[model samples]
Target chain A: MRIPLVASLAWQDYRNDAWLSACSVLALVAVIAPLLVLFGLKFGLVSSLTERLETDPATREIIPLGGGRFSSAFIEQLGQRPDVAFAIPRTRQIAATAQVGTLVLEMLPTAPGDPLLGGLPVPQGLEQIVLSHTAAEKLAARPGDWLETRFARQVAGRVEARDTRLQVLAVLPLEAFARDGLFAGLGLLEAAEDYRDGRAVLALGWDGEAAGVGEQRVYPAFRLYARGLNDVEPLRVFFARQNMLVSTQALSIAQVQSLSRNLSIVFWIIAGLALAGAFAAIFAGALAAVARKRRELSVLRLLGFSTGALLLFVVLQALYSAGFAAVFSAGLYGLAEAGLNQLFVQVPGEHASHLLAHHYGLALVAVLGVSAVAAACGGWRVARIQASEGIRDV
Target chain B: MLNLSAVHKSRGAGSQRYSLVIPALHLRAGEQVAIVGPSGCGKSTLLDLLALVLAPDQVGRFEFNQQDIAGLWRADQQSTLARLRSQHLGYVLQTGGLLGFLDVRGNIALSRQLLGLKDDGSVARLADQLEISDQLGKKPSALSVGQRQRVSCARALAHAPQLVLADEPTASLDPLNAERVMHALLAQAREHRAACVIATHDEPLARASGLQVRRIHCRRDSDGGVTATLGEAG
Candidate 1:
């Protein structure tokens, strides 16, 4: 009952004092709306893309870097790392030339000893090639065609690989390679290049395997794998430290999403500043109210109120106003966010959670802090009044 | 019971020193006293001393209800005096210090609430008697000066304090309103069997009320002393 008296009096004061409350609401809306939207979209996109990356394993090491070569020694070294689960050394090669019919054709050759190459129509005991759907269209070559491949370093020089021939075993799907085009085994090209250079006399060079030389091996790049997607970062970092050019497509995507969200945070900051200004105005307004009501506090003292009770009354009043304002602001923000979402499809999905996570607690803390500061400023004037001051003015 | 003997209060020290004195004044329970004075006299100061708001720099055996109040510690003194004031004394400041935010009814209710009085009927009855009942729903800002003064009286009497102190309650009112306020104040003080002390310069209003009156003269000799003229007129 006693508490209600104090609480009711405080509520009455807050309600009757409209201008300050309006200012406070305006400031709160300004700060909180943008913070919610910014934090919301940031969390939304980051989590969404992270979800997709975490789900797939094939795309984990499909890094587009260093002209598409998977080196064996690098794959061996990557497999030795604790985080790397499986490293596959695969090479891609592109040999573009003009055919006898004056038509341009691109050849993609594959390694000889790969397990996945067994079912293809490449001629038995001969190194074979898989052609892309588009590459197959221009080559005018079938599954059994003796595909003559040409290689030339300078246009003025003779076409040296005009005599090299192979069979196109399979027409691979168009989507087999990335949208940038071009896919093949780097080992086959190396073997073919060795033949043209007269290294075929070495006997071990044309087969795409050097047998047992460790230091003489070269690979375009290594396709590094991991136990889980999270394992990729440390593995990537390890290779990067070795001066290997590395890229984390997933991380980059996350960063872009975060950038978009961070941009919104600036708007939130402005809104927050507005709320602060409004709160400052609230403090000033409440202080003015208290100043005007000095005689009332003196009256309470005259009616046997303890100094503690007087102070309690003031603090209670402030807390009541601040608490009510916080609840009101949260509801207002929620409604606004919902309405805005309906109007704009680009409104990120996770915005509400982000807003609640970051700004809600902050607003609560700020409201209380501002309320307390206002109470202290206002209480200062009351503490100095002697009981006689009330009656003397009358 | 309230008692004061050789109470002294001074505004400043030595060269600028001025003292207020109330010599040998006593009031039993259920007694009303009117303090009348000219301007610059220490009537309000005497009331302040009695109210225990300002302590005398020096004292000669001043007591309140047989308690030696002269040597009480600040906390102990405030508590003791505040307890008495809450349950037994009502004060009406000269200018009707009604809180601006509260409506007339709420202002009247504040005294009872502050004093921890549980009764609502007493507050309502006082509001009716002070003629502030019709204005109860309106804030102090909506009321005229006279209406606010009436609301102040209603608040003072609402808690039924045993002692009521009115410092120039009629100072801001015209003759008719002053008479109305004085009559309401004196009538309520009698009904509650409370002792009421009013400090005022209005001689006719003080005389017409027909209560026991005391006149105070602040010493002009620069020592900050008040000379209490006892039982001046009744």
Candidate 2:
């Protein structure tokens, strides 16, 4: 009943019944390999999707609604909130146009770190502008190119305007925004305000007050971003409490979370069923092995092996088979992961394309647990063999 | 050394009862005894009882090596009996009872391995004595019937137990093989100063093997009960 003897006997028996032992190992592999691959894919894909969501500011974008002016201090206060990454005031200009000799283009005020800009730096002064690729092509301008343009605004049934020369600081790529518009700094808004008040020499003189005095300088709207997707809901609630309307992609994120949770549940259920089947197969195989070696086991009993020793012998056989199966399952998982990644190469977005090492470790532990239980069930039979049975069998 | 007196073992109840009774039996070191009986006799049953594999319903006295071991059959003494079996006794079954998975050398050395004893070249020496040296690396299934029987004998004597029990050790062998196996078994048992008890139906062979012969006789009574008794042969 010594461990060495049991091990030697178990190994010898394994070699003697190579086909049956191989069958048991294959059954374990059949259950473990696919389960590991599935888990690996799920983990990989979820991680990739999470990475994408984190990197894209749009997922955390918050747009404040209503067309009214708010003080610059209000925008600054909103930006200071812990949940807010950045908040920029936007003014809606009526008939705001830029004329470069014979070419005319619409101008929009933009802020630094705006998602629409695709990470392009914002223009820092009234002399600087960021042109869309299409707009730049139309104007025949590149970075550091000076262009002359005039801003016009209407008041009291008359047009008031001023001409300004601006330098193109950068051109937005197609991925940044496909639309044909010029992005300008707050300086442009100041120039527009000056023209609206008839302060420019080219404007028709009128007796109207300056637009940016006190509360009258409030912006029509503001673009806001959260530090992270998890902060979106809290920021939305805060904005709503202030009677301010906010827009975000929280609903899409929630939908994806729910789908991922459901998929995980389904995957575990299938894995559980597969493990149960594997347990049954391994248990049945152990039982069959016990029955086939009944005489041998009885002889061991007669040779002074205790029931515990016999049980150990049987358990050792099961562990051997499980060990082999786990190795094979790992190899098969590696191959399957490679094949799946290759198959999904053309798919867009972040793809979980490889099995993680920890997942493989977890699979090994699971297989060992399953095999141990099954082997114990089988070893119980060997433990029950009476020593006298050896003689009776003879 | 072994001793048994007024031991009783029975199977079934009432009308279907079959019982075996041994009034007294004794064996000393270096003694060889063979229980001879025809089929349907309790020869194997007696062997099992003496080997402590089958528990007797009651016993007046059961001693091994001058220690009263009759009470050792209690559940509490199970481990004690197992230890004794491993350290002090050996067994050979009728069909050789060799584990097919192990090679000849492994099979012969199993008892020594279980007892946690160093080999001391006993298995090799025994194999040489039994002319099974060439068969040591082969599995039992690869050996002939006679060769397998010799390996079983070598296994029984490997650990040098104080008592060796063999049930029909040569039941399936030809006359020549039967003589050769019995000769080797008895010679080894004597050389090791071990008491040996063999059960067989061949009375002539049992007597020729220089073993004190005892016969087991069974009779059915009118009430559908059977009784078995053991006594010395004439």
Candidate 3:
């Protein structure tokens, strides 16, 4: 028989045994549907967890363990590191804290592209400050509001209280920082540390002694945020190599990464077993169909259907089942995914369970490949059937 | 079209062994011959050998269309043999052997389709000649036993093969239907200028159909086997 004839014959016979063909399709669907759902859940879970870590300012923060001498040039170099999302010199912890209206807010030095600012403009001068929501609430401050900030320093033998008023540049959302803090430019923080060290704050002209006492600007630590959670551990390692210890949210990052890896391993194990079962089902179905229609196939063989043609005939049916099952499994997976998304979503239409378009395409290709191999195994038996057998029996 | 000498085949083994021998036969294009024998004889076996399906155990000479068929068998040219079967030979079995999936038209057109030949209207023409024009749309399962036999005949001749072989083509039909099927098969084969071989147990029917008669005789062998021979009528 010709290839076209064999293909048509395979289709007709498959239609003739429509019930049985449907059963085979369902068997393949049973194998594929769970695998798709499992992978989708794994992918979605890991993706969202990783996205949450990536987007959170706290997770990206890398805090120096203690104050150490760091030069201005070194801080510049630190800012250029690929893992460093934002790096600016920070004053000693003692001087970093200052008093506002019934609130002690830590002054963090922020520069351009600071993730904490979340696209908010950096404070331009010593008088401008970005207050965290809690700090703003505590001081009852809003943008354009001026608040008195007090910092005390011992000058010679006297403890003097110096006061400066700062205008709030912006109010940061709680997701950026939940604590009592204020974001300001480098000059304000430097001047506060200078005043605490009994040096003149020449920029503010609030002097005790001159800052040009043969000293260049230097910092004890840096305020840094990593590019992402993936950068946190590496940045911590980089800091340690420079003899500067840092702390980060590395543990949480590891937990999420490990969860993703373990989930993948489990998914693949289950998928492998399911695929093996599917292959067996396809193989047996192909073989049984051939055996059931042995006389018909043999007659085809006698009528000049070559071994190759006969093999094509049998394999075509198996492939049809696999192709149909792949499509149906995708549909079933879609339904299950919708149900799962609705079941677990925090908001409607925000699905936690999902699969990309390529994933469905990959599944179709894989099922077709496996079915072809399995059917070819069954086709091997068909290829061996003697045409003489067809003549004698029929 | 074909010449054979010393063609032989065997089935079973030891105590249940059955063997068949075709000493010699010659046929030309459009020639008609029938192998007439009892049921236990090897009439079907002879047809199978001539159809190139049953390979002869040993053949002194077997030639078809000036090609060395005996050499092809000796060299294990299976593909070549299958090609010969498809392109140059046709067979009608006792059971019609119609694929249940295809209707009567599909059944008849199958042979030409195998050769990748476009519809030369032979399927419709054969259906008309076999008086199965009305039944062309029906599946073989829907046809009566006699109708199925005629469909099988149409399928065999539709390709206009050089040789047509029929093994008890009317075995399952009533007497009147049997005569009709036999006549149709012969008429189509002759119309197509095909060399024809019919295997049947009914000698009177074979002679009445104007087919030159051949015969097969079987005798028990000393080794608990039976040997059957085919040639001129005993």
Candidate 4:
């Protein structure tokens, strides 16, 4: 039989059994909507997490311990490691203080392209410094403002100090730093190191010229960064092989990814169960329809409709239900996505929740495939109906 | 044209079996034939066999349009027969058997749709002739028994089949409605030059239709088996 005739006949059957058709379609929609919502939630949450991880360079940052006086040569050597993107020496002072007149704050040395600096401009010259937003606010300083700070040292149980002046290059956003801290270039850090070791330098506002002019300045530790998150573990392993301790956010990132994957599996199981129920409902409905339409099917057969035509009619009816369900489910998915996105913004100051296009396509395929298989089962039964059965009614 | 010679069909096996034997039957274009018999006499069985819906155990010759088609009951041949039936045969059941989902017009056009043929005004013309044109849009449930029977007659001839088979088409109708339905059926069959076969237990109505008659005689033996024999044509 022609496809149009089969389609028209199936449509007529659907219209004739409006209540049954509506119930079947509603049941399918109930099954498909939740599955789609779960899929959308999975995609939205996972993509949001992944996007955050991708944008945050600190996830790849590595800190190596007990480096014991890292010279420039050692820093450059660490940078030469293929997995290492860049390396810079950091002082172990942890809480050295910087004073801009009456405003004293914790200070640390920073390097170019430090992940913690996060887009804040790096200090370039010997006299330049970068301040956290809070520090900048307390000091009332902006870029091109000069600030003065004192470094104190304990020498044989007596305290001695030296003062240095530096120009602020930029102010970083508060989230860029773990706390409100003042940041300066290596020159200022070296000066602070010298002062802490009881060394004096006339050029850096000390009593006299430094006596250790020819000595090599070595850092107590180094801050390392990898090219990507996947390289962080390798860099840590490399440091561990050298009897050095390293720290990174790799463990936390891994935990997040694992949690997301496990949640995805759980959601999939739920969706799978719902889909199976949907299939059962559709299959049962189709079977019941076939039983009820047996007389009509026999009449068609008696009218010379081939078995294939009868089967097509049955399948077309089911496909119509599935098609309607898919459309309804998609609409529900879209509304849910929009509502959830509005209800819960994933990232601060950004809209990060959404269902991907490919995910919707996959859901469509899955639902339609289930519908077709379920409908075909009913069609098989219809195909077995004999034309002689109509005569029995007579 | 239709012809059957020495066809044999049976149900069950051995002592509990019932069987039918047709020695010879032939019909030409525009011929209207009735096979009248009591209940359990294998009249419906003979109709089903002629419609190619039932397989006979043996047949010397079963020809339609001069084509020898006896014993064509294999799976492949059954499919071929189905195609031929779709193209060349029409049927009206005792209860109208119209699809409940379709209206009268759709029921009439269904066979043509199944055969992949376009309606060339045959359905409308037949509906007009059958006086069911006003009810073409009504479903079978809305029509009276007699109106339904007339509509069934219109549907049976709407596809312009070469042969029409109707099983007790007026068995449930009042005498007047039965007469009207039979007259319309035979007139349409004659107009289309298609042969008609009707199976019924209404002897007087069958004879008064001015068609050749074939009687089926069946008797149960002492062993619980029935033997049915087709009487000579009259």
Candidate 5:
């Protein structure tokens, strides 16, 4: 018989036994919907947690534990590391302290691509500076304001003070840094170091001995930040191996990583169990249907349906059953997904349960593949019946 | 059209063994032939052998539609046999054998649909001629035994195949309904211009219906088994 006739025969048989079809489809749905909802929960929770860490600059920052002599070359090489996002030379803690409008604040070196700035304007000019929110509030200053960024030094056995007027370029947001500090270019910090060392500073032109500012400049330390939360722990360990302990938020990152791993393991175990159950139920059902519908198969054989045609008919019925179950299961999962998101509304960031279109497509493909194999196993039994059985005794 | 010089089939083993022998049978298009005998005479076995569902134990020469049926059987070309069966043959069973999933209309439409033939309106005409037009929408379970027999007859001839095999087509009906069903089946087969072979125990009815009868003669064999043979009578 032709394919349409054979396929219609299969369709007729499927639709004719409505109760049995409904029961099998419901059986498949019972397994598939829960699996989808479980996977969505695992994916959604991990994504939101990771995104929370990923969006914060503090998680991506790594600062050295103690002050040490770090040469300009060392700082440049640190910047070359793939995990480093922003790095600049830092002066000694004592020399880095400065006063702006009667408020003493730590001066940190900064450049472009500084994650701490969070896209705020960088202080590139020698006479420009960016203040942290706390420092700006303490000094009652804002961007475009001028102030005397003053420093003290012992010049020839005499305590002396020097000041340079600089414009405030911008103020870092409170989320970037809660402490009182000012961000200036590396040149300003280098000039401060030079002035404290009693060397002639061309940028500020202080009264001291002439020296080349570029001759083997060595910094006491460097400010560093990682590219991402994942890079922070690795970079910290890397610096730790060199006897330099770097500070990072590695504890929270490790906790989130372990949580994601555990949730994934749970999801896979449950999904595997559900898949096995669905496979067993469908395989047994298709096998029993072959036995129960022996008379109808024999009738088809008598009607000149080839053994191959009959097998196609059986598989077609299975495909329809699985396809319907996949669609209905996805619908049920959608409903459950909404409820889950609503339940977790108090938690921050992305929905509590979510899935993409391709995930559902993959699930459908897997269900169809398993159903086809199971049905093919049952269809082979239909071939053993001969055409004469329909009329042998009757 | 079919021709068989000698085709022998055997069933069972030991004491319960029975055998059927068709010495010679010839048929042409639009002809009606009846294989009549009492019960346990292997009438259905002969029909099965003719339908290509049973391989002959022995064959002198068996040709169907000018093809070597005995050779095809020997070669075990089951797929080819199925193709030939679907393309050229129709069957009517005693119990109506209508698929319960399909309505009366779907049951009748199966034959032509199998042949991939377009609807030639013969289904409606056959239902009209068989007087089951009103019952076409109903399922086989809902119809009377007589009405089911007519639906079976319509299905068998709806595609106008080369041959129709009717196995005890009226066995489950009353006497009046049996006669009516038998006449309706024969009349539809004639209208489709197809040769038919009806297997039944009613020899008198076969004669009354004007069919050429080949009644099987049975006797005890040398092996303590029953042997039945079919040949032209009168």
Candidate 6:
């Protein structure tokens, strides 16, 4: 007979044993629970880190220069490299204040079509300003409404022009729009710089740009979206060899992935220990069942039951316990994962990213592997039975 | 028929060897014999050897009905002995031989099952004859000594074995329970036309049963070997 069939019978006998049945079930659960938790943590960390890498351009770049001027000059050069798929130079600056009437808003400048600003709405023209939902509400500004962004320049010992305005282009999505919300295109930053300089600072300037202003230079950053994360390193090296100060935050990605990997290992280890306990319980249960049926087993031996038959019977019992436990654990783990996900919200557009982000492949492997081991342990005693002793005391 | 010639049994070896020597023994079909002896006479050891439950240290020409049983491999011997014992030999122990996990019926059914006897009526009829029909659902622990003994007798005789071995089957029972157990056992043995071997010091049972009685006496020989002398016991 198949060992699984025999294990099923043994499991039935174990169930009749009552106390042993409970113990075996407990062992199975112990093994499965930790594996599920570890799997969840691994997926969570990996997803969070990948989100940071792919969504934030600053983190993806190999080099970020200091200043409002971004050199699109290297964009054409970097794009020609065989290893690089897409590289786009972007003007990024931190504006301390965007004063609209009595309201002062935080200005974060970003690229117009960056993948990182996925959920936020960006405008196509200079007349439009994409206000954060909070900023829109604070300024009482509508999509078509015009808003002024004033900047004060400190040149020499004097304050220059302090006022400027940009049309409120569009209102961003209310959900997570304020979470590091970006104002795309360099026009807004340019307008703010113009307000500081008093004299118009547009296009390239040679002399008398501002009282304290020196020669113009470009402060630049670029987003390099390669086909794979492995491609990120070669590009980093290429940029470094060119005498450029390159900084790729791929280490952050590695840190997240590593944390996820470590957490999974820890979870599986803990889960494995619990599973071992469960397996022991199942083994003990099988032993007790055999002990209870000592006379029956003896009788079977007398009836020409080969030791193989007895082994089959025991194996069947274990399979039965494990099979049931597998189904139960899977269902329970699913329900728990769903409930946990519902209870914890990471972000709104967090779903539609990559293929491997939230998958519980590791967890599945852990649960099944542990369960199989546990079941095998339960059947060990049945296979090792001494025919003489099993049959009778004589 | 069973035969044993120059059967030498011992535990351990060399200076520690505790040997029991039974020169020759034979039992024809339908002959009930009792092995009566003092304590530590190796009566149980002889029974164990005869039952083929344990192998002796040495034996010359050991056979059952002309079939040589000596020198059979342990694995083959175990299966062969199990079949022979299940079908032809019954053992009745003193401390409630019926398993505690099994009810009276299960205990009885177990023997028939072992013997590959599937007839429920035969089992039911035997249980009725043993006077344990009403207590078939009760475990050995739940039954009185006399009832438990009767259940054991039922199980032992369920498949109608050729020889029934009783190892002090009544030693733990009261006089009445012991007599009842013996009477039930002997009656079943007779019904099956089987030989009964009762290894016990119960003289009352020995005398009243009217079965052939053989006494085994153990004494240390000059060489320090324990010699078991077998003879007719009054």
The clash numbers for all candidates, in the given order, read 17, 4, 1, 0, 0, 14
Per-residue alpha-carbon lDDT of model 3 for A339-387, expressed as tens digits? 8887887844345788899988899999999999999997689777877
In candidate 5, what are the lDDT values of residues A191-303, reduced to their tens digit? 88888988878767787878865678767778788887888888888988999977889999999999999998998898888888887887788788887777778877887
lDDT (CA) for every model shown? 0.63, 0.81, 0.87, 0.80, 0.85, 0.63
Query: Fraction of native Cα contacts kept in each candidate?
Result: 0.69, 0.67, 0.71, 0.67, 0.62, 0.10
Q: What lDDT score is found at residue A384 in candidate 4?
A: 71
The CAPRI quality class of candidate 6 comes to incorrect
* TM-score-superior candidate, 2 or 5: 5
lDDT tens string, model 2, B1-234? 688899999988777988998988988888888888887678888887877777888999899876567788855465677778878888878888898878999999988988888889999999999999999999888889999999999999999999999889899899999999999999999999999999998989989888899888888877788898998655
Task: Note the residue pairs that clash in candidate 5.
Answer: none
Off by over 4 Å in 6: A1-223, A227-247, A264-394, B12-18, B28-31, B64-68, B73-89, B112-119, B159-162, B190-195, B203-210, B223-225, B232-234
Cα lDDT for residue B153, candidate 1: 82
Q: What's the distance in Å from true for residue B77, model 6?
A: 5.8
| Tens-digit lDDT string for candidate 1 (B1-234) | 777666667675555665666667778776777887777677777777776666766676666656666766334567676676666667787777777778888888887776566775876788788887788788888987788878888887888777788888888889999999999999988998888888889977887887787777544454443343334344
In angstroms, how far off is A82's CA in candidate 5?
4.5
Q: Candidate 6's error at A154, in angstroms?
A: 27
Estimate the Cα RMSD of every predicted model relative to the unseen true structure.
8.9, 4.5, 2.4, 4.2, 2.8, 9.0
The C-alpha stretches of model 5 lying farther than 4 A from their native spots are A66-74, A77-84, A140-148, A165-168, A205-207, A228-254, A390-394
**Who wins the lDDT comparison?**
3
Better of 1 and 3 by DockQ: 3
